[model samples]
Target: MAIKTKNISPDGKRQMTMQQFTAWLGRFDADKDGKISRQELADAVRGAGGRFAWWKCRQGLRSADSDGSGYIDANEIGNLVEFAQKHLGVKIVGF
Candidate 1:
């Protein structure tokens, strides 16, 4: 089925903007290495009050890390947010 952005959040409370996604990505860069690892992504999501399985989070990071560097940057995070918004139907707003 075709996915739509509007289908991301049903309550319209978790819609996250590009800026917010970028900010979250920055915060997730725990080591400040300009990239976020699988663990870092999980920690970042958890820290933001979002619950996700560690393995799942890791898998997501791995899938989104297009450069094969084992890390995800702002662009990757943005894509991830868009994917989550489309699939999870959670309006991920600014934290």
Candidate 2:
């Protein structure tokens, strides 16, 4: 089951569109495996000017890896998206 993420803005409107999330995934799915690995996520975070903490990455994987796959797949993508938004506080535009 996909975890639900509340993307509503202050006015309770959708803040991010699906296309934006898909584009975000494409930025980190370097192998095109439909999943974001720890290294890929770390690289993406670092590339975004965020501190790359190995421990935090592991924690993130644990938080987002709903299926115990050690990677963030489509089902858990919401968690990763929320993590980046909360932690990095950057508007991730297309690459």
Candidate 3:
């Protein structure tokens, strides 16, 4: 059987899959607590060739966090991608 995938880009272009996003989030969880802290998110953003100021990173983390938790999870990472896509007009394919 052939498997189907969903595209997240605005132009219907194929982008990173959910599994890939989750894997990337796993890599970002430096402390391996199944959650990503603001510092970890900032480091990951910087490492991914994106410039992030301390305050901006903190705000991003707060915005991406949906559950009101202090940390972000894999799902939150997906939301972060969408947020960046909307605000920055950049397509984040993966980590």
Candidate 4:
């Protein structure tokens, strides 16, 4: 995630619409290539102060990149919902 637009709940989980969640993820597209690369994802998580960002990104990329393209694309963003909610503390409330 981009470490921006944090909407925390009382229980400490971040709440956001799917739009906000995807936007946050999109903020890390450093090359403006319309897809999130492994390096970009790792950098973003590390920038967010997440522990073991490399490892986490590895897993996230593995899980989210359903097509094995080694990047998260627009069509595959929803595949990241589960990983984001678990590791990124995001709750995508709705589309």
Candidate 5:
């Protein structure tokens, strides 16, 4: 399947700005709570054509859920950005 992405470049070599990255991630915020749940994150990875989405989600949540609230809030999204870039090849501009 074609890679589903809004911020990634055609050649996949450019970096996505934080605003772009968040807008992309915002698509998966099913509840519209302004926070990303584990399932939401997994869905995002899967939609991005990522492999091992659940595994990546587990690890991503582990590190990103700094408050241990089982949710990635605004403060924690920056953490998830790293995981997305590394595992999902999102290439966010900066952390």
Candidate 6:
């Protein structure tokens, strides 16, 4: 199935400025955890009008989890953003 996404531009692209991404991470990174869990990602994806696929989400996490922590931390958020923009066609605005 195709990945779904909101917060996209009318140009048919997912747009996420660094500031926007950081703010979004903070909201879901509840429990004061430094990392984002798969469930959190799934919730966020769903919230963003995207379909949640466990394997796909895991793949995304793995792609960005540079430290192999199974979670996306601040240090790895850039990687996550890159992955989203690259494979998912998300445009990192204000880059």
On a 0 to 100 scale, what is the lDDT of residue 37 in model 6? Answer: 84
Q: Which lDDT value does model 6 have at 65? A: 88
Q: Give the worst 10-residue stretch by lDDT in candidate 5.
A: 1-10
User: Model 3 misses residue 78 by how many Å?
Assistant: 3.6
Ranking by TM-score: 4, 5, 6, 2, 1, 3
Model 1, 1-95: lDDT tens per residue?
11123435556545556665566557657688887788876775565455564865676676688777777875576557654554344455663
Q: Which segments of candidate 2 are over 4 A away from where they belong? A: 1-18, 91-95
lDDT of 2 at 84: 62
**lDDT, candidate 3, 48-93, per-residue tens:** 4455546656777778899988688766766677754543324556
Pairs clashing in candidate 6? Answer: none
Per-candidate alpha-carbon RMSD to the true structure? 7.2, 7.9, 7.1, 1.8, 3.0, 4.2
Which regions in candidate 1 have their CA more than 4 angstroms from the true location? Answer: 1-12, 86-95
RMSD of 5: 3.0
TM-scores of all predicted structures: 0.65, 0.67, 0.63, 0.87, 0.83, 0.74
Q: Residue 93 error for model 5, in Å? A: 1.5
Off by over 4 Å in 5: 1-14
Model 6: lowest-lDDT 10 consecutive positions: 44-53
Candidate maximizing lDDT: 4
- lDDT winner between candidates 1 and 3: 3
For residues 11-87, what per-residue lDDT tens digits would candidate 5 score against the true structure? 57436778777787888899999999989989988987888889999999998999999999888888887787788
Task: List candidate 4 stretches off by more than 4 Å.
Answer: none
Q: Show the colliding residue pairs in model 3.
A: none
Q: In candidate 2, what are the lDDT values of residues 1-95, reduced to their tens digit?
A: 11123565554333455557556556778899888899877766665556655765776787789899888888787667667655444333332
lDDT of 6 by residue, 1-95 (tens): 23334676887886777877667656766666878888776655555555444655677788888998788888888878765664455678886
| Alpha-carbon lDDT, every model | 0.61, 0.64, 0.62, 0.82, 0.80, 0.70
Tell me the TM-score of model 1: 0.65
